[model samples]
Target chain A: MNGSSKKYWTDDPEMVERYVLGRLSEEEKRRLDAEIAECEPCREMLRRETLLAAGVRRFGRDGLRSRLRRRLVRERRSPVRMYQSVGLAAAVVIIAVGVGVYQMFFADLTRPTQFGKKEIVITQGGEIGEAREEKREVRTPEEKMDAPPPEAKPAVRSGAERNVRPAEAAKRTAPEPIQEFAPAAKSDAAAARSIWLLGTVVMETGAARTGAAALSAESRTADAAAPQASPDRPVTLRRGDVRNDVALRQRPLSALPTARRSQMGSARRVETLVETTGDGGLQLTIYTDDVAASELDAASVETLDGDSLVVTTATQRILYRLPPDLFTAPSVRTKR
Target chain B: MAARLFFLTPDAEILDLIRSGDEEGLVMLYSANERMVRVFVTNNSGTPDDAEDLLQEAVIILWERVRAGTFERNAKLSTFIYATVRNLWRARLRGMKREVPADLAERDDASDEPSPADALAGSEMAAAVAAALDRLGEPCRTLLLLYYWEERSMEEIAAQLKFANADTAKSKKYQCKKALERILTDERII
Candidate 1:
């Protein structure tokens, strides 16, 4: 075969094509195949064309596969519907079982932590700008004692809000501090809630104006601090000729609405809002209104039902029980 | 109603399975696309036998490509099969009609019948030969493929490629084969 190929092989490129395609006669194909088995160049040319032809074939068939696949799927859908429904039901059941098992075996047992809520009201003429929050535990007592206080962050204060306390009415009015505290996540991972306040904090426990600085119906008293803004309305005075007649026409105690009294009761009973005012005072405005009830932390919500003045200061929080009527007077005064 | 096999499997994995000589993969392909190929051939002046032959030949070509790892990754398998079956069927139609294919779908503008090379319609080489063929190029590559791969006559080649005559086609083939050898020699492809 080699001898035959050698004799006729001179410049015979077409022979490679013919041999590959099997156009060669029986004798020629046999001889060429034998020669190709031995000859490297002949072998390589044959292989390349074969692959190229194969690639061309693959290209032509490309469009048909996807279309036919769709057809096959369409044809089979009616028969598969029953099985599909069964499978879907099985999947739902499995998910339910999994959830039940997890609840039975992996549920956590710890009770949810409770926070004492306080309402800090800055009463500067009776314009009550109340701020409420329960906890701000960034520094341990030891750490707070060791460190100089950090530079204060920005807070928003309204003209009325800033002047709620007569002591720091000089504070510049600015936007209230936008402290976005994320709702405590339900996850097991516990992290510190960061607090940034610009004004004085008045921890408002429902009780205010209960001490010697407060007034009776027949007397005038004063203590103009945050946690209460003096009223913006003009005074309607009614002084009686009787001795001890600082006679302010008192709104009959019956005039206090039942709901307001309850709300005020809860507001005074439990601490709700803890606002900071000028000189960083703890401002508390405890609200027992249904609206405020929704916001008071669990601990302070309970505390609101009691008449107590909880003063949250830079050092610590102090709870003082007092009569709910302390806030009933239109205006209160600090002893001269 | 049978679940369609191809839909259940992705295209890439189908190629991988076919390359691995999985019978299920080939059956999935046949189940999905055989009707289309049959419809195509019967519409194009081909008999049932002709359609069967064309499809079987397409399958053989697919098997060869997958085995050789020559199939393009991005190209769709169905289109490649369609093109192959179509090309092969056209030649078969030409064979059936000594003068010209009567069906419009099967008809081509070529004025003449294929020469002797048409006899070598379908074939594959040993892996070694294909590897060596990789080294040859140009007029040689096309010449070698047409004469050997497609098995067209020198007359058909002269017409298709616009060579002067059968002799020109013949001489071109000779030079190309020698060039093929030279390429293989330089690369030590043997």
Candidate 2:
């Protein structure tokens, strides 16, 4: 074992490892120790093995410990990053909830297109009075149209609907705001018996047009009534002879067939229209007739009754409720 | 702080990490016993730096045993770690005592302890080997570290480094060790 050419215990890799790891028995260790003292090559081999193990341990320690320390440093700073991420998420959720709450409780539901209905009650004596206007507006058609003829639509009247005020009617009809207007009532007598309303319609304008006019009718009352034609229905406006000078003297008091009636192949352009409301009611719109007011002398006039008159020109209309003629004689002549 | 949280990790997980030769196991053991070792060393005239170095050495000892499949789960991991730290610190303190010339000579002559001259040569050689291992570069560097320090089996080395088999891993390790020795010899570090 001491000779350079002879095999020593340290020449065996497993023996060298077992010796270095202190795994040898006392006798084996004593024998190896004596051989190492006498054997220069074996001693050098043992030293080299020891040094290699030490070097690897140093490298593993430095590398693994540095990584662990870095992790410690990074983790020390992570609480703030976690808070920032959590706070951003919380802020987003809060904003979303705020918007939803505003929509549910605070947002304005009624738009300009929605108009509150105003009921105008016509008494048996032909006196017309309107219900008080409500603060809330009604929801109507997406696009405002001139009143159609008085169509008889059967409104589904619930106990809730029967007691619905103007504001409640607006809410109750909100779901189906743009219902189609039914065909007009057959006659003025039928219209006089139905519920009548005064409404404003704001026409949609082009995006480029900023100042489109909003057309609304002012409610007025008739001050005079014609002689009762029948007891079964209230006396309403009846068309009269246009050429009669005596009937023409009824200042601002004339009417014509409704626009809906005119639309039924009469070929006459209807300047004024009366439409049935969506909820089984009737609506009459008296436009502020710019053409009639500007050309009063040339405005076409026809008789309705002594009380209500519709004065219209080609593109303009005005519904005038003349002063009651209780003091004047009833001289209206009905056209056959 | 998150590393401190790893101190709560159970011993079973740490053992699994050791058996798998995961470096994270070393980190966990180092951190888990860091405070205890710090207190022990500092109370015994050792600084915080000494405590850290001693703890790392102790953990490496455990890693070597665990990787070699020789570690006994006879006690709690922390208990083993604390005892190892105590022993390492005692050894370090004894070495410090031996730094004096008269005591070093007496210890060297009286026992099988290496003489001061031999210790200095050994320290220098160890440093040279470390530098040569660095220059030896990857696969070899890792192979030597796994074999010499972690004492992992050839089969584990093959699986970990994706070698075809344990025989292949053994062959590669032989080559890597030769290369490391070559670097040391060429650099006149041996």
Candidate 3:
């Protein structure tokens, strides 16, 4: 042990760790302490080790504290408190049901029925054609919600709702039916004779109450047709890109986006849909309840306005304005 | 509803949660024992803030012990926490009692207050160490904390971290420690 110079205790890192953590035996601890007092490097090493240990301890404590505080805030916001009183929750549900029932019957009766009679005029070969009206029935508030014109029947039955094609419905209900647009006889001859079933809707305005009903029918139609076309990728239309006045009217005020509400300011709802005629032609249908000035020729191609294909029907002079890109990219159909 | 269930969770389940490193159990422990700690602290001349701080500290101590496998099951977790809180509050009260006026402390030779230089060095050292640990990150930071602060065994650390064995854990610890030392040296911290 008696060399010219003593071998430093700091040479052994394990011994230094043991000494720092107070794990050294009493004799070894005393020897190290004596050496540490004499050696400046040993003292510095010990100090750093001690600081590192304390810092790690502090870091652990701070980390735990932060996590605990965050969890506390989250727990406070959690809905666990809802189940604490089942009676209060039941009472809330009951009150909601009562309000809904009152609004459905009593409130509806008090509301002024601005129900406008609508007629759909279909034209062929870009010539002014007659839309012979047949059996007309007084539309219920429910029918008004659907906003289907004279030709389109309210498909009240769930199964019938699936395929509520206005042209087909008109043919079935109309006694002296207007001539139906001929579908292509075969896929090979599809390009030659394409039929464009242009529907012109005429009506009088009073459309504030049909928001929810309009959305349900519109969404259901979209959902039903979505699988047949573009089954892999769903189509997403930007606001104002495709507008359904009926759906917009039926929409709950709070449910409408701020940007949408601003866009629809002072603009009347004109429901329209563009269906692919299988042979490259487009079947455009318009549904509206706004009062018309005069019935224009429905068959005239000149009726198709700029961006908006404005068709003043044989009865109602209703203008249907569409987004500029509607005809160019006609995949996403709007609900009328 | 879950919060109510947590309040009713037995000590064994709470301990299991601690062992599993679940913070939910710690939260439950913090919440369930809060009233008792507050009552005790307030009665003993402590403020609500003091009670909260003491409770957090006590819960942390319990967490550390349980995680490190050093906590004895002889007493309930709440009992251990309460005892720890009591000890901490007593120490704080003693420290308060030892406080002297600045002038008296300067005159008194046996004062325990750190010199300005020592205080500055201590804070700087703490800051540097913290910075180095942060830079180290991940399993390295946690491994060092488990070893140095929590004083967990290599085997326990291996199991917790899903390492192969104690030897692998020890080797990893060595590598992590060297990496930490390099960061500290690069940053002129150690």
Candidate 4:
């Protein structure tokens, strides 16, 4: 040790601490020990350091130990840690349920899914319709004309619709009952002639579709006009392209994109299928193929015609006619 | 591996708080770690007031260590805090001439359930040494704690205490040790 700093070994208490606390390097420790063995004063200092070092170490150890215990607890109680675990579990369950609902129920409501549903519903409707057609098949034009209109039957009627004039009432006030169209002639040549019954529709969408179009037009006009412009702004269709400009001038139903958009906006998806069989007697079957995302609220069939006569909602329509020979066949006459 | 606390604040913030001597940090540290400290003190023959006083002193000691770069950052704050309180309470009990638990004399062997050991002839010297430490100014007290008690390196002490270099830190440490000895000699406790 340096002679100048040698007395401070005992004079400076922390020097004795270095020796007492064993903080010195191995060489220093060996040197300090040899000095302590020879120097009576240094040995006395070592005894004092031994006592102090033990106390200080105890204090340091206890302080450090307590801090560790508290840290463990804080770690366990940390909200972020707990929430992460909980949130992941909850998210998984929610996603599972959502996917299940989409596949089981919501998926079926979509346009594509409704196609299958509509096909089934259309089959059911066709069965009911075919039943009605069978009843029609048995009756001759003469007997049909003699009977009252089916709409007049109290059991088969409902709503203001029942009293509404039939669509073709103007053409047939007396209703010749198909004698003019397909007479049940006794002549074989007459029986063989192709008979057609022009299918007539009961107008349902005429007011609704037109109203929707007007609303859409009004909305467009209101939206396009400036804030300072008058509320009575007339709707103006922008002719952005040559085709649209020509279409607007023509004033056709396909005048503008808005016109087509309005038509499709109010329309729901639909499909129809028809199957004909010649077993026993001429039989025709028809059913809907695709229905809208919602319920199949209405399904109807009439004549040998289509899903509808006048509306773009038909999707597809088919018709079939039976041979006139069926009415006057010799097998039926021989049986009589 | 520790999870972040509220507001996702970093763990190092605790050291900053202690270093800065912020009142809020002290309060938070107390509330956060009080249950462990209070339980240890009261169970070991201390009153609620003793627990509270010891906790306050421990926090001050921790701040001093942190401020002077004497604190072992690797150690958990809770363990350090509670242990400081326990040690202080035991020292105070010895000063009061009360019979300390036999297990309190020896250092803990990690099991926490203290086992009795023979008391040394110099057990009475603890209070005298602690008083001598208290007489040393803030710098000297912290330097000794860092060098002798906390086992911090001279280079670390230089950086933490803003010494010019490790040599200056060593010189300053020798001066502080001299100061401590002077207090012990003047008091005639060592």
Residue B65, candidate 2: Cα error in Å is 2.5
Model 3 residue A39 lDDT score: 83
Candidate numbers, best TM-score first, in rank order: 2, 3, 4, 1
What lDDT tens digits, residue by residue, belong to model 3 across residues A60-134? 767888899888888776777555456688889899888755643345322221213322222222212222222
Per-residue lDDT tens digits for candidate 4, residues A1-336, read 324545434555555655665546678667667776767777766776665555454444445435644654575577975898789989998998787546434443221111221211111011111111122133322122222233321110100000111222233335322111222222222121222222122233443232222223433233221111111221121212211000000011121222112212222311111111122221111111121211111222223332122221122222222223333444222100
Docking class of 2: incorrect
> Candidate 2 — which residues are off by over 4 angstroms?
A1-5, A80-336, B1-9, B98-122
Superposed on all Cα atoms, the candidates' RMSDs to the truth, in angstroms, are 22.0, 21.0, 23.7, 23.5
Candidate 3 lDDT, B1-190, residue by residue in tens: 4553343547877887888789888988998899999998887878999999999988987887677565667767777777777766765676789433332232221112321222332366766776678889889998988887667888989998999999998999989888887887897877
Please say which candidate is ahead in TM-score: 2 or 4. Answer: 2
Whole-model lDDT values for every prediction: 0.41, 0.49, 0.51, 0.42
**Least accurate 10 contiguous residues by lDDT in model 1 chain B:** B109-118
Give fnat for candidates 1, 2 and onward, in order. Answer: 0.04, 0.37, 0.42, 0.11
lDDT accuracy of residue B111 in candidate 2: 17
- Residue-level lDDT of model 2, residues A1-336, one tens digit each, is 445677788878877866665567789989999988988888888877666666666666566667767765665467876898889999999998887556434544221111236433222222233433234412111101222223422111100011122332344322221111211111222221212112112211243122323222321112111110111221123334222221111111123222223222222222222322222221222222222222333334333465444544333443433323211212211111
lDDT of 4 by residue, B1-190 (tens): 9874453343466776766545446556666777887788788888887776677666655664675464676556777776666666666788899988886776432112211110221265655665567666677777766776655788988887888999999999878767766776787767
Q: Pick the candidate with the highest lDDT.
A: 3
Superposition error at A294 for model 2 (Å): 94
DockQ of each: 0.05, 0.18, 0.18, 0.09
